[model samples]
Target: MNTAGEHMISEIVGYISELVPIHVDKTKTELSSIMTKYHVTKVENEDVHPDLTEKIQLFLSSKRLEGLAERTLDGYAMELRIFADHVKKKADNITSADIRVFLGNFPNLKMSTVGKKLFALKSFFGWLAGEELIKRDPTAKLKPPKTEKRLPKALTIEELELLRESCKTVRERAFIEVFYATGCRLSEIQKLNVSDINFQSMSCKVIGKGNKEREVYLSFKALFHLKKYLQSRNDDCEALFVTQRKPYRRLTGRGIQREVKNISRNCGLEDKVHVHVLRHTFATLTLNQGADIVAIQEILGHSDPSTTQRYARITEERKREQHKKYLVL
Candidate 1:
């Protein structure tokens, strides 16, 4: 064999040695057999690129500084990690083709989920280009996979009453009312402090996405239940909601979701409802009852008017359904 062939074989052996848990000598016989069956060519100008993991960390740090919520940061990190693992290439070496293959690898994922992964990649590469970390953004020309626009599913008034009746405790009752009344995100509600509420004003301030603070009003029924729940608790935990047992702690987002799902099951509702469903319900019902789209947008802390317009679209659909069902000549 020529010097170039020997050099390529030695590089392959070294690479395999790094991957195997056992010693290199033990695998050499099997490695030799595989090496003899294939020829290797060394590519020129195979430049070393910056580490993918390090670049991802920098991207996440930049996002954190921009006030993205921890959950959102976590999601971005996960998607990027998946990309790094699949491509096994450094940040600068990643190409649009690599991204396309990475996305196509998950054949079972929905288009919506694939779109989200694509979005994360786009954002990361866009940042790298802006910071001069990469000469070009790989995702600049890639289009996200098309996804269907499904209408938001909001509970009917009768279903809402049924869910209210299914509450097994004052805390549950308060949670249902407050969630619907404020239309707060699950994280926003979980982070609420007891001091954030003002009984006299019938409102409370919540820290929302991007750490932005917003005031949301409580309905009379919500206030009545919330005040009752607070009064009923003996523990001095400062959170607006607490676990029902001793050594009381602030209710976590998962805990809140579990409670809501339990209530949903108890009511025999067809839809498996969670906090986000309640948020949609709140927006849909409010829009149906004559609330302005822009007003709901502000209340929901939506930066874009188009996001709020979804609920308006839901209301319009419902109006058409009602007209078809009940309107008579």
Candidate 2:
């Protein structure tokens, strides 16, 4: 083989070794033999331009224009960059087998991580196909890895009371109460403006994922605590939740997580506590009190009923356990 062809074969062997967990020498020898048999001249397609990164940027731009959340756009960019790095080929030149190998290489990744990566790649390739950038979609037949269906962890009423008791400041108390009462996602609560709350109606509008707005009702106790917290704040910032210090800024998701973690530690709860747990507690408690699943779905701003159905699963499991323990049979 010519020097250029030999160089291409070596590069192909190295890439295959990275993807397959095989020894470099063995992969090189095997690939060299296969190349010799097939008269392979090049690894990457000669006609394909090296513009995968540029194409990805364009795709992300389209997503931004479509009003995708910045976080979601960031995820797509990161995942696609990882895929491009692994495959080391032009977007249009990537094959289904190559995509499968790239994903399979990350055997240690969480199922959710794998699923997110697959979704990004599938979307990218589907877009490319739609735009006639590629002859076929590489991810058309690809399936995301199945994630385990673990039930949402929710704090019991007694544990919640303990958490409330652990809070020495109004801010912490009000934050926990709002989480339990509204069942809002951490991002939703953090993005809340002070003007969003309607004290008379005891409800607040939360901007949820995809910038969808929904009303989350506040309990009487929650309303009282929120009023107290707001009264204590001296900042002119419009954010409902803000840092306690001077020059107060809106609380971030991480800030709320830290607050919840500290409160859980102070309360001495055994299980790990976080904002989502409080949201789960709200849903489970509401369902146990006979709230309709459809109503819960709407309040939670769930675009799909199946996502809301998980709370119903938790309620059903509790009923089964109670039956087993209390029945005289």
Candidate 3:
């Protein structure tokens, strides 16, 4: 059965189930009978149009040349594969209406998830049109759904202190301090090498999205703990952070994340804390201390100024709250 037909059947079944409380097993049996009588067979093996696959390959190759990250390329490939499997149409024959219908099928997904899908499609179709692979862009008129601009959540000074006190190991203490000081993303920190640190300059080089390298500063406190952790290590691993056991290896991103969750749990914090929360705390605290937005952007390795501006907004709200609490008038 085609997607549309399957969707229609699902809707009818849902309506019947809601209007009359039938036994769930009986409902499934009856639905199966209906499907069998109608000779409705799922068309899962239809060959995707060669033009579509060819254009997707060309688009991904161009994006690779343009310095897109491998993870980003994989996401594009996954989204495009789903679209191609659904439409099974040539790149040139795909219409905006078809795109709309495709998007409509994902009614239960979050706006952010749907928006990501739309972005991938738009990028693929836009690339095809730009390269003259397709005469017209099917997604030219499509717009992403607006996502809410929530302030980045930062840890309070008290919460930071609590987390610090919760650390049971030198490595854990060092991990928290470095993440809080540098504001590097999880991947950046995971990929960090001991050689990347320049103790003389109190800074380290980190490769951010799109493999762009930038320098992030370490605080005196972070340097103290990091040095202590390194001194405590007996392994020969070059990774800045490594597993505690013998035969130690570079800590994976998930390993770092698991450590963060453990610290959060140990701290008895009400909110779920992650690596990005440490990043937000760094940005919020630094900006509150009068760091320049542009400078913070460079330190955080943000390609877009607007992405760093969210931290500015957070400081503004904090300032207003401080004023309210302190005003004597």
Candidate 4:
């Protein structure tokens, strides 16, 4: 029998079973026999359009060709894949209402997370419209959630000193020093080659987001620890930092994070210490020391001066505290 015929028979059997109060065993046997004879199949939604998949590939290729970092490309791909799966439709067929519904479903997510997802969708749909693949951008009407402004956390000078002292190995000390000195992103530091650093000048070239290269300087203390670390290494991996094991591979971002956490715990720090906090510490300290915002922007590889201005705000807060203590009214 066809699917409709089989479905009708199952419904009839279900009503009969409920009405007659037949034994469960007999009902199961009868249902099994009917299913075997009819060969009923599970229903599934239609597959997403081939054009949608093709467009996604093209978008990724464009990002690669535009010199986006690998990690950034991976994020874009993952975000778009999730959005596509949630919608389960072609890009052109997606509607603003559908996107609103999808985003609304993620109620438990942080505002920043929801904003990131919305930004990804907006970028993807914008690209589709630009390429003329879609008549209208579905995400055009969507607005990202407003996230609360939180100050970046920076370690105190004493805490930094204690953290550095807690490092038992030359490698760990060097890792912490470089992170605090350069203010580079975790991925930028992880991708650093040995040749990128200049010991005499106390500076290194880092590839920031969009594969943009910038120079970041190191402090005398950072240079000293880094030199010590390098002198202790026996491998020829060419990476600035490597694992301690044999065949020493380059250290990954996660490895560096774990090392930082271990050092933080050893130092008895109650607050979390990660690569980004180290960066915030660098920027905050530099601003307090009277470094110009533009110079901080260059050191931190921030494309926008406004991003570097957060440290200036920190400085203002410090000044306000000092004024409160010193003013005699």
Candidate 5:
């Protein structure tokens, strides 16, 4: 949503965000009460058209389109409200200048945060243009700011060896191998079912972002651990990965992150060993072994080559060693 409406709408948003356990379907009366309490209505009286709210609700509920996730739909609504305030209240027609004004205020924002807002505006205006709601797109000219090309943290070969050697449970080994083999996002991996695995080919079929399906290969060691884990699985449950706890639902991203951290700590590894690190490790190692960068991009299911190029960059150790050989400094 646009910046002005944000203050009023956010005050009206349920105390706990919808991303958390808080209920998102609060009454307009409840929203008005919140606005009154916060005195946000006084400052932003023209913000968030009530008709636009109904339209957004209808759009989110329709399964024929994207934006299904509850958290995502909520965020989109908030973003649209912000945009509507900025656009509809404009004295003159909205243009790239208005968009520039919105983006220009984010100098103090973190790169990730700035990226999200830009993405929100882009999507909102794109939707408006698609529906013929707008004659022209204000966000059409917006550009994502270039974020620093910091390499993802990955375990060194020795650190990986140490961690792999430290694993006493077959479950731990399976988690590590699956992460490295698939390079799937944590959310994708968490949602994997037993049917997603190809036992004969030793590959995993993952539902990636945008609901795209991609196949990722497994190593011999990865397959070994997976097979071992499968032997202990309950036939009644279809989940590829399950916790030891009762009710036996899917494992969460947080659960996997904690497991990786515990394993890293136990093995005395210095690097932070999260799931994304495992994916980066796979990409880096594969690129180092002469695998094509484009192939790595496909394997990791990245739509952009620029995203994969970060993996193609040399490691710090390699750069330091190269400087030693030059001896000019």
Candidate 6:
């Protein structure tokens, strides 16, 4: 493989990174054709002057600083395409006014959905601004909807106990413990191969959004459940979690989500308990247990402390802890 070809294809990070090396053995002419077809040109610096669509594609394609699961990348791609078409059709410099107008025009969108679309715009514009393609970051003054800052919906101590009682089945326990303990995303958990778990260290390696990788620690309880789940597994499958549905197979992210809801319902919890909420529960529970916010960021594979701090902000334990210290020491 030529230099650029080898560099571009083989450098993927994630569970895939741990696998066989990339098949970048394209002929020099083939590589040249690809570079030409894409109109990819290297700037003086380590940058490319790709078009709006290609730029976003490149931004997504290039390695992520904080790894993420592939499904997340797909979602980001979908969101970006939506935003790209929106902005491009209306003409660029797609200001905050444009964003608000576009969203407002689409009255069918819920605020949460609006917020997600806005976030995708923010990421898109931020990248454009980085390349000096845009004069200003239109999303600079943009605000996500002021949805109620309710404490992240979580399984209460008792509800968790109920989940324990109701989640007696093997897969249920595995789902609960793994999410509550490691805080890995549903996609990450679903994509997890048994090889990723280091039982001796009680750590599970996760590939997070953007193809970033991090090691999430498993509690003793979670580790035990994982071991048990593995023991019950057939050697034919390599996935850490699998389904009981006939012709049993590796579970998908949706599978885990459905299981979370089933477990939540059977335990009599009215609220839905998706994998993310369980992950949120893990973060908040760890914080309440006095884990450092920065440490939690690492465990959760968040690139920015501010992102991890969102989980902390939604909770009172951090503030209450601060108040008590002022009273004495």
Worst 10 residues of 2 by lDDT: 40-49
Alpha-carbon shift of residue 262 in model 6 (angstroms):
1.2
Return the TM-score for candidate 1, rounded to 2 decimals.
0.82
Clashing pairs in 4: none
Tens-digit lDDT string for candidate 2 (293-324)? 99999999999998888887445667887789
Residue 315 lDDT in candidate 4: 53
**Over all chains combined, what TM-score does candidate 2 have?**
0.80
Deviating ranges (above 4 Å) for candidate 6: 1-69, 80-98, 129-147, 313-326
Residue by residue across 260-306, what tens digits does model 1's lDDT show? 99899998873657789889999989988779888888889999898
Top model by lDDT, which number? 3
Winner of 2 and 6 under TM-score: 2
lDDT values for all models: 0.86, 0.85, 0.88, 0.85, 0.73, 0.72
**lDDT for model 2:** 0.85
> Once superposed on the true structure, which residue ranges of model 5 sit more than 4 Å away at CA?
1-47, 58-107, 268-271, 315-329
Runs in model 1 lying further than 4 Å from the true structure? 1-50, 314-329
Clashes of each: 0, 0, 2, 0, 4, 9
For model 3, how does the per-residue alpha-carbon lDDT over 172-281 read when each residue is reduced to its tens digit?
Answer: 99999999999999999999999899999999999889889898999999999999999999988999999978789999889998998898899787365888999999
Clashing pairs in 5: 1-79, 1-82, 2-82, 2-83
lDDT of 2 at 240: 90
lDDT of 4 by residue, 1-329 (tens): 56665665667677887888877567656766766666544333555555667888999999899998888789889888887777777778889998989888899999999899899888888998998989999888887899998878898888889998999999899999999989988999999998999888889898898788899999999999999999998889999989888879999889888888888889887366877999999998988876888989998988998888877655567788878989999
Clashing pairs in 6: 66-212, 67-208, 67-211, 67-212, 68-208, 68-209, 68-211, 68-212, 69-208
- Report lDDT (Cα) of residue 83, candidate 5: 65
Candidate 5, residues 1-329, lDDT tens digits: the string is: 33444555665564557546655556434665554544222334556555456555555565226635555767777766666666554322557876777667768988877777778778766776777766777777777878885777766688778888777788888998888887778878888888888889988888776667899888888989998988977656788788767778777778888887878778776367767888888888887666899989998889999998887767677678767988786
Error at 150, model 1, angstroms? 0.3
| CA deviation > 4 Å runs, candidate 2 | 1-50, 314-329
lDDT per residue for candidate 6 within 158-225, as digits (tens), equals 76777877886876898888888888877778888888889888887887776767888888998888
